[model samples]
Target: MANVRQASWDGSPVYELENGTFLASLIPEIGSNAYRLRDKIAGRDVLRTPERPEELRASPGHYGVPLLLPPSRIRGASFPFNGRTYRFEPNTPDGHYIHGFVRMRPWRVVDTSADGDTASVTTEFRTADFPELAPQYPHDLTIRARTELNGASFVQTFSFRNGSDEPAPFGFGLHTWFLLDGEPERWTLKLPVSDIWELNEKLLATGSRLPLGRYEALNEGMNLEGQNMDMAFRIGDRPVEAVLSKPGYAIRYSANEPVTQWVVYTKGEARDTICIEPLTWTPDAPNLDAGPELTGMRAIAPGEELIVRTTLSIERE
Candidate 1:
């Protein structure tokens, strides 16, 4: 059996969905972010959760699955779309706009349900609902998020729609912080990425792609020990999968098409958690002069919709 109910996490309101094997918790007011996913059978956490509400409030994107609108850094805090310039407040230390401000806003929970084998919660956010949003991007948009737990798998599905009178430039990604178990060296990783994006000193894509080259071992499984990376790669439209594993357990992550890029990051010696982020566009995509196919940059016409689904499945050995 499965159940979904409102719960509290360190004094913050959250919705929890639990099946027999796994439990998931999300805060509707915080980016509809799913901050915790625990493997009940294994007695371990699958996602790195914050110690308290203040920890998460101070750094929203570093703890859980925080949604990034127009995902990643944009050069100079502005970009051109449909002959109009869109601007955002510079949020990064380098005087650039990063990951958008959507992750810090509140979302409205619309529904929650539990069935025989699954529990799910749905939340929605709209640009028009927040007065301050109209000036930042100007185009009306809505994002519907659904978080579900079915037995051993946790899924997040996001539906985006351009509700403005004119076309809107779009991009989306999840900054998913995954927990590590034991020593970092005890873990290994397998990614579906084929090529690496050439990035500049500021970690922004340079509108170029390079072969995996020395990193080809990632296609198989590579040890995490002593590995330092904050890299982005290109993924195929097919439903390819990535896995992060240790001796006794593994986490399988998959995201479908329209999600063409992924960013992988892990601290070298200070490694505690890894971030396997799915991105719809490369960082600084809007500033790139390349075509959409290469840069993963595109616009959503008014009334048009984009849907993306991703899952994190726990496998116990």
Candidate 2:
């Protein structure tokens, strides 16, 4: 049977979930980030975590499966939706709001249960509960996150609901830092990509796309020997699957429909951590001079809800 417990990580509150094959940690106090996931049978950590919990709080997105509300960068820290402009404070030196601030905000753990072969925890964040957010993003929004451990697989589901009468723009992303053991050269990565979003010098999409011919090797598995990537790819109109393989095992990440893009980043030879982010839309979607169909831009109408699920499973290779 699987089990869950309220624990502490370096004096911070953490919910620990353990099954027969894996051990996971969820921090509700800091973005409900699943900061640590370890595969017991393979004896390896699947996600890269900081040495101390404080380090993770200092830089949330770089560590665990941090949720990006609008994902990646936004040009000039603002965008247009329904003839109204929504704005955010720019946090990057380049004058872009890189990855929305939801990941750094606190979430409330609403439930935790262990039944049969699964153990899970559910956390929630509501904009209505935070009065300060109205001045910036006045929409009434509720985000519920549920993390589950079922056997050898780890699953995450995020449900977003717009409580406002007006339509609300929506784009969700997870900046997941997948770890690579042994030599980085021995690792392999495969993405189900179609086209690459062309970006300006500031790393925001430029309303143009490049053929995947230049990155054809990624469709078929490619080695990480000297690969340096900080690019986003438009996913085809189907389910998405991406795999990162190491010597003894492989980790597969998959998502269902409504997820149309992925961003991959790595430090090449300097580090063993790689981030293959799943996003609902390309960065700067609203700012792009294109239709929502091409940009993957989306809006949740009044009383509407959007749900996206992503799963990470360990497989022996």
Tens-digit lDDT track for model 1 on 1-317?
99998978877899988999888889877788888888888888888898887887888898889899979889989988888888888888988988887898899999899999799999999988888877778878888999988878888899989988898888999999887764788888898677888999988888888999978888888888888889988885434678999898888998877788888888555268889898989899998987889678988899999899998898877
Alpha-carbon RMSD, candidate 1: 1.4
Error of 1 at 124 (Å): 0.5
TM-score of each: 0.96, 0.97
Off by over 4 Å in 1: 237-239
> All predictions: root-mean-square deviation over Cα?
1.4, 1.3
User: What residue pairs clash in candidate 1, if any at all?
Assistant: none
Q: List the residue pairs that clash in candidate 2.
A: none
Residue range 56-174, candidate 2, lDDT tens digits: 88998888899998789999999988888888888999778988868988999999999877999999999888887787688898999999999878999989999999988888899
List runs of model 2 lying over 4 Å from the truth: 268-270
Clash number by candidate, in order: 0, 0
